[model samples]
Target: MVWSALGILLSFALVTAVHCIFSIQMPSSLETVNGSCILIPCGFTIPQSLKESLKLPVSGIWRNGSRWFTGSTDIYNSSRKLNEIQGELLGDLLQKNCTSVLYNMGSKYSGTYYFRIETGFKYTFETPVQINVVDILPQPILSHARVSVKESTEVELTCTAPVPCPQQPPNLTWTPELGSITETLQTDETGSYTLSSVLRFVSSRSHHGESIKCLLQTQQHHSVSDHPCAITVLYAPKTQIEVNVSDPLYEGSNVTIFCSADANPEVTQIRWFREWRGNVSEINRTDLTFTMTKDRVGFYYCEAENIYGKQNSSKVSLNITEHSSEDGYDTLREGNSSTVKWLLGCCGAVLMLIILLTITLCFKRSRTRSMQGSNVNKSQIYVNFDKNFSNLQRESRDSECGVYSNVSNSQSKPASEAIYENSSI
Candidate 1:
């Protein structure tokens, strides 16, 4: 029974030894940044008899999708391996310790790595190790070059990322979507890279929403990283203006003048001035309305501006007229002048009529006197034959003649005077 117990104890110890040989512990899973170095901690426990004769596997050998070996493959090489397959490796593996290191780790190195230890008893134990490689470079960030700029102005763009792989600095390049890229530059110090690019080209409204990108490429493995920056082209503010003046404004009356302009990107400032005077005043509001004087008669204009640029509108003039005292004064002056002309014409016409009536009365009086003298001569010859009889007849006739002459004279005088007076007046 004691011999049986010894055999059973030996078998139990062998199984325990085999289990411990395959159960190798690594320093937690190794983690490293890409293009950097990482040391994979691997140590094993094996039965003393097998440890003396067992050979360590070559560094950097592929096993189950992982580069499993004593050390990293990128910097290490053994005479037996191809040049392309050689990688970095640490110092010689410890025979009794069964531990090794790896260096120059990269993203491709991330995976489960395993190694097999062959024993003289025909038993092979396989141990597994895990590794994780991380990209240390931060995600690319991009920003607008400027809010606004003038045409043909130079534009600047910036791209940044957390520096990764100090030993292998990255190269920077810029690609433009609409305009041509004039320059690309990178600033690197202590393993970090800040890439900047400038594009000097004419700008237009068509390029308002265009894009540009900055790309970073690692020297090793040609790994590519990129960030995009937008271009915002600045331009002069566009302005259109209208001018107006108050109507019915007299020469000396105060009148209001107005100036207005339309512009894009919102005009930051507006200035008002008269051409006659250098600058009347500057107005904060786009539309300016102010009481104007005759001095403001010259051309007036306005200026519109923003962060980008400035523009001015065409000048306008303000005209004023003099006011009259009363509405009827203008009309009355014209009426009085016309009345004076009419009175003078009427007086001349009356004088001409009086002269004509006097000439007609003289002609009639001379003709009547000649006719009376002829009648007196004929009667005197007849009266000489009978003196007494003639004398009596002549007296009677004279009395009748006197009565008739008086009546005729009175009627003719009143009628002639009445006609003359009516025409003169």
Candidate 2:
């Protein structure tokens, strides 16, 4: 009890030195992660006349704005409990310290806060402290002057990404490869930056179904892209169809009519029609497998469709004959049939070559991937030119593996003798 009385006298003596002026020390700003606690490093000097005794103890309050202190919005107070707020003063006022702690930081906790101290001798209000709470940013926005255009026409598309902090702006990216890119920046009243990119390009039929995307990237390496905005390039189909029928189309002979279309946005549907007596009827279950009959011979055309509209192919007529030369139907419309046959055969050969190349590429890629998955730190193997592939003894760090390699050295052997240089594994 004597020690307590001595402490009280010491506090009273300290309170005798305080003046009207107080200095508040706070960092320029502070950043806090969501769902965490933050320490607002604060220090003050109140003329060293601060006495925090039980009879007339010094009290402090933290506010979220520059409003006058009335305890209505005090986040750190002992008597105000109208609402639940997790904060407290963690510094000794007698020692000229006013640091505080805030728990469970969230978006609502972000703002400029001021500290006010009320003592028996005097009161002082500190400068505001700014706080920023970070979370996943909002998605970028995409806009365009025109989303659809005709072939060779000009159009402009714009993408905007909002950066809540003027000091840190998000990176923006575009897709589908456009031309004449322009950038602009704007700041809102709240001192946030918004970056925009404009892509000026000429639309082509090839870009009908293509999409342009805008990606926003943050310093944390997190990225989000705008929803795909498909460009609708309008144009005619420029359609053409092939009628694959026997040259003669003789009675009782099989014939096939194959139709192909090329258009912007890729013909949504194909319609086959047989026109007779100036009237048209849709042909279903039609291909190159139909038997040539009187009813089957006529002018057939195909129509292709898309968002813009539909286009009709040139009509192709097939005349069925009762007789056929032993060599089959005539080659063409009075053209050489052998040349047509040669052209078709050449196309078939080229298609086969393409298929072979694709298979080889696929196999090579697969083999490379498999080799990458192997553990090659340590291995044991035996090589013998005369040994079979399966008989080779191989060991790996992970498991036993057998490598089959065929190496031939022609210079060291006769033409009839195949010499193995490093083929055995």
Candidate 3:
């Protein structure tokens, strides 16, 4: 400790020999992130009177607050133990650079600071430097803890984070990813800045019982996060009723129909309904079943009701007939029942048209063949008559057998000679 005091004495003696040529450069203000390190850039010039003091040792010190010359308190000194302080003089005193570094900066290290230079017996203090140390980055706060809405309905949520400075504005983000965000800046009477992000989204049944979180970060990277809130999306009751029946459904047979619904907030009431003979009857239960008979041949359905609304399952008819082997009445399936009759009528019309065309073709073909048969019969009869007439003429000429024989010998001449004789005649 004595040696350190002697070093301070010599440092002041050397500065006393120097005239005023001193110049120091430092930033007016600086920002520091919590739990990080920062460098305070500083440079200084020595006086021309310190020529002989050049061989002397120079000492640099940084003290807390702006009152360094009045011995405010040493935060960093060349002669001080490093374990006693959280700052260091990084620049070399011989080069007139008084740059220093501060580690583990927090709110306690905030406010103005100054640098002091001691050369021999002379000491001088520089101007004050201000530092703004951000201790904690605020987390995002949501306006609503839990939000509930119906399907296809538009809902809104607001998330906000405090901003210490307008320059370093905090950013807000939301979970369950969404688009088309509406952002704004809000300030209250407290003079503190707040960054607000509005989320306008359409809630569906699929998003029920999910979490929505708002993340707040000072920067894009190395960001901080906040807690999450749950979402409860309400929707209309999803009614689905099942009617279980065994085969051979006849009179005085017991049947059970179970009705259920899936919905948020659960169903408050389940209603069973039966429609027969233009009369509507309501039965307040999960199932509506009675003695199956011809009188009970009608439509029945189940309805579920909640705070949101009500929904009904498809109707089932309880029909009893001699050929009705299965519990026959099921809802108009796939909307086919509404159009089946029209489709069948169209098919029957097309089939009748095709049959008429086929009959017409058969009639025309039969008529044509009958006319051809008549002509063929006429030609055959004429041929038969000509052959019979020739036979009769041959039999009648039998009495002139001798003359006939002579005429036959004359007519039996060579075909070419006969043709030549005929040509001459």
Root-mean-square deviation per candidate: 28.6, 32.7, 16.2
User: Which window of 10 residues has the lowest lDDT sum in candidate 3?
Assistant: 325-334
Please list the C-alpha lDDT of all candidates, in the order they appear. Answer: 0.55, 0.68, 0.73
For candidate 1, lDDT tens digit of each residue in 323-388? 666657878988999999999999999999999999999999999999999989889877765787
Deviation of model 2 at 47, angstroms: 26
What does candidate 2's lDDT look like per residue over 123-149, in tens digits?
546577787876755567888523877
Model 2, which residues run further than 4 Å from truth? 1-131, 144-153, 164-168, 178-180, 188-191, 209-211, 225-227, 246-252, 260-425
Best by TM-score: 3
TM-score computed on alpha carbons, candidate 1:
0.30
Q: Candidate 1, residue 181: CA error in Å?
A: 13
**Root-mean-square deviation of candidate 2:** 32.7
lDDT of 3 by residue, 136-210 (tens): 555678888888777888878888875544544557778866545788887654333578888888888888887
Better of 1 and 3 by TM-score: 3
**Any idea what lDDT model 3 has?**
0.73
lDDT of 2: 0.68
